[model samples]
Each structure stands twice: as C-alpha cells, then as structure tokens.
Target: MSDTDDLVEIEQLLARYAVSMTRGDVDRVLAVFTPDGAYSAFGDTYPLDEFPALISAAPKGLFLVGTPVIELAEDGATAAGTQPLCFVEHAQHGMRIGYYNDTYVRTPDGWRLRTRAMTFIRRSGDHDSGRPHAFTRS
Candidate 1:
C-alpha cells in the first residue's frame, strides 16, 4: 500500500479501537491488536488473553480518542503513534484525560497494535482528588 493508504488505514484502525471500547465489545477491541499485543495502563501490563477480563471488570465509559500522530517506519513494516483521550465513566460520574502511546506492526491480516501504554494526566468529578493516582505494577 502507498503512504496515503497506510495513513488512512491506520487512522481507521485507531477509530475502530475507540468505538469498540466505548461499545464494551472486548473481542472487537482485541481484534485491533496482534496476537501477542499488550496494553499498559496505570503502570500495569495486560496481555491479549488477560485484556478482556480487565475490560469487563472496569466500569463502562465513553471513550473519545483524539487524532493520533502516526509515524511510519522506514522499512514500512512498523509504526508508532500517540493520541490524547478523554474517558467518561458512567458509574463513577467522572472523567479521565490521558494519552496512549502505541506501537503498530504490519501483519498478514493488516496493521495491528503491538503495544499501547496509556498515561493519565487529569481527572475530575465523583472521583475528584485533583489528578488521578497512578497505579503501581505489582
């Protein structure tokens, strides 16, 4: 695929991720990642197999993903990006603002997330305490 095509596909992939998460479809969300992909948030790492349980245990929310800054690799097989996000939890009546740092790789199926690390910058509402506390990995 050409550079333009790659960019469009990558953007669509990111959008799908947000939509899937908002819809609470763990399977669909996982589809955006590679088999060995991982998501790190609050300093904890979740592998693909464990991700669904994590999502299921979390409160449902509205996920808004901002435009990502995608950089294609020179070899055309890998890419990386970062995107700001706002998450509003219905149960908690609060919102968290953060950014996701992502690594992408071209696979036989398509471009997939190799890893995603999220850093929360702010929070407010029922959970208010100024900024949210970061979780430490055990």
Candidate 2:
C-alpha cells in the first residue's frame, strides 16, 4: 500500500478503536491494539488486558462526532493524531464535551493502537450517572 493508503487504514483503525470504546465493546476495543498496547488516562496506565473493566464501566450511548487529524511517517511505521472528541451526552442529545489524543502504528496485521491518552477537556453530567445517555466515536 502507498503511504496515503497506509495513512487511511491507520485512521480507520483508530476510528474503530474509538467506536469500540465508546460503545463499550471491550473485546473489539482490545482487538484494535497490539499485544503490548497501552492506554493511559487520568494518571493511570494499564495494559490492554487490564483495561476491560474501565471500558465496561464507561457510560453507554457515548459517541465521538468529529474528524481526526492524522499524521503518518514516511516509512508507514508510526502514525499519530489527535481526535477532538465531541462528547455528546447520549440521552440529553448534546449536553457534554471532551476530547482524546490517540496514536497508532502500522503492524503486520494492519494498524493498531500503540497508545491512547484521553484528556477530558470539559464535562457536564456524570459520565457514569446510571442514567440514560447517547453518543458516538470517530
């Protein structure tokens, strides 16, 4: 694949990662990562296998509504980007906002996440309020 093609594939892989996480699809989320993939957020870092509980406990109906800015290296080895996550409160339609900085790598199996550092810029309503919610990811 050309560099552009590799970039596109990496973006898609990152998008899938976001979707899987937002939808609380732990298995699929983990599949988007390399064997030693790492996720760090809120001063906490853990391996892919140790992240299911965190993903599962996240709010449902979550969505990522925005285009990601992706950057690819010439060798098609490392691709990184920041996805401005528009955190829409699922139930309330548009009640919250946030973003995540994501990074990926092109592996033999395709593109997989190497790291995902989430920064909750601003938020409203408890993400895990146990109340209804709606949202998507990109």
Candidate 3:
C-alpha cells in the first residue's frame, strides 16, 4: 500500500481504539494493538494480556480523541503518532486532558499499536496536579 493508505489505516486504528474504550469492549480494544502490545499510563506499564484488567479499572468516561499527527517510517513497516485526548468522567463530572503517544507496527493482519503511553496535561484545581499554567509575572 502507499504512504497515504498507511496513514489512513493508522488513523482508523486510533479511532477504533477510542471507540472501543468508550464502549467498554475489551476485545475490540485489544484488536488494535499487536499481540505483544504494552500500554503505559498512571505511572505503570501493563502488558497486552493485562489490558482487560486495565480496562476494568478505567473510569467510565467519554473519550474525545483528536486527529493524530502521524509519520511513516522509511520502510513503511512502522509509524508513530501523537493524539490529544479529553476524557469527561461520568460519576464526578470531572475532566482529564492528555495526549497519547503511540507506536504502530504493520502486521500481516493490518496496522496495530506496538506501544501506547499517555501524558496528562493537568489544569488548575485538578487533584494531585502541580502548577498547570504558563509562567506569569508576580
């Protein structure tokens, strides 16, 4: 396939991931990742097999994922991208903002995530968060 096709497929993969998580579909979520995929968040990394537990521990939320900025590899066998994320919690009506760093690998089955990690961009009044603002003059 061409580079455009690869990019589109990766984009689709990311969309599927968000949808699956929002729907609490474990199997669908796993399908986007490679067999040995690893997801890192909350200061811990969970292997592919532990994803179900991770999913279970996840809070119910609406995941609003932004379009990823993807870059293809020279050989087109791998790719990487970063996508912004916004999650609105159901119980507390709270919100969390973050971005996902994902590495993609082309498998015989299609494009799948090799690794996925999240970095949160905390806002003011957020619990356990540090200064979440731009520098200001005193």
Candidate 4:
C-alpha cells in the first residue's frame, strides 16, 4: 500500500480505539491490541487482558472524546500516535482529561495496537496518578 493509504488506515485504527474505549466495548478494544500487548502508564504495567476489568471499574455514563495524531512507519508495518482524551461523566466526578501514546503493528488481522501508555493531562476531580514509566516506540 502507499504511504498515504497506510496513514489513513492508521488513523482509522486509532479512532476506532477511542470510540471502543468510550463505549466500554472491551472486546472491541481488545481487538485493537495484540494478544500480548502491554499497557505501560503511570509507572504501572498492565496486560491487555486486564484492561477490561480495569475499565469496567470506571463510573457509569462516562464518555471520552479523543483526538488522535498518527504517524506511520515507512515500511507500513508499524505506527505510532498520540491521542488527547477528554472525559465527560454524568456522575458528580464531572470531567477528566488525559493523553495516550500508542504503538501499532499491522498483522494479518489488519492493524493492531502493540502498546498504549496513557498520561493524565488534567482532571476535574483530584485523582492519583504516578509519573510516566516507559516510553513507546513504533
């Protein structure tokens, strides 16, 4: 595929991830990641399998508005991107803001996320988050 084609595909992949997460569609979210994918954020490491459980714990009626900026590799086999996330929760907690740095790989299944490191930019409520740990490379 051409570079432009790959970039477009990468953007779609990133947007799908944001929408899936916003809707709490765990299966769809998992589909984006590699089976052995790692989520490194706030100095903690989590497996792709554990994400569903974690996200499920979030308060109900929460929505995330994400804007993603994608960068595709020359080989089209890898990609990297950043997405700023803004959350709207119906509960008293109000809004939350965060950023995600992601890495992706193109497999027979199409494009899948290899890693996602999320960083909290700001939040309406006081939340506890540690410093960023490992950085991601496409």
Candidate 3 TM-score, C-alpha based: 0.87
**In model 3, how large is the Cα lDDT of residue 43?**
66
Task: Please tell me which predicted candidate would have the highest lDDT against the true structure.
Answer: 3
Better of 1 and 4 by TM-score: 1
- Minimum summed lDDT over a 10-residue window in model 3 is located at 129-138
* Alpha-carbon runs more than 4 Å astray in model 4: 123-138
Instruction: Name the runs in model 3 displaced over 4 angstroms.
Output: 124-138
Please give the range of 10 consecutive residues that has the lowest summed lDDT in model 4: 129-138
Candidate 3 lDDT by residue in tens digits, 41-75: 76667789988877886688888999999989998
Clashes (backbone N, CA, C under 3 Å), per candidate, total 0, 11, 0, 0
Name the lDDT value of residue 69 in candidate 2: 79
- Looking at model 4, residue 27 earns an lDDT score of 88
Model 1, backbone clash pairs (residues 3+ apart or across chains), number: 0
- What are the lDDT scores of the predictions, listed in order? 0.83, 0.69, 0.84, 0.73
Candidate number with the higher lDDT (1 or 3): 3
Alpha-carbon RMSD of each model? 4.3, 6.7, 7.6, 5.6
List runs of model 1 lying over 4 Å from the truth: 123-138
Candidate 2 wrongly placed segments (more than 4 Å): 91-96, 123-138
Candidate numbers, best lDDT first, in rank order:
3, 1, 4, 2
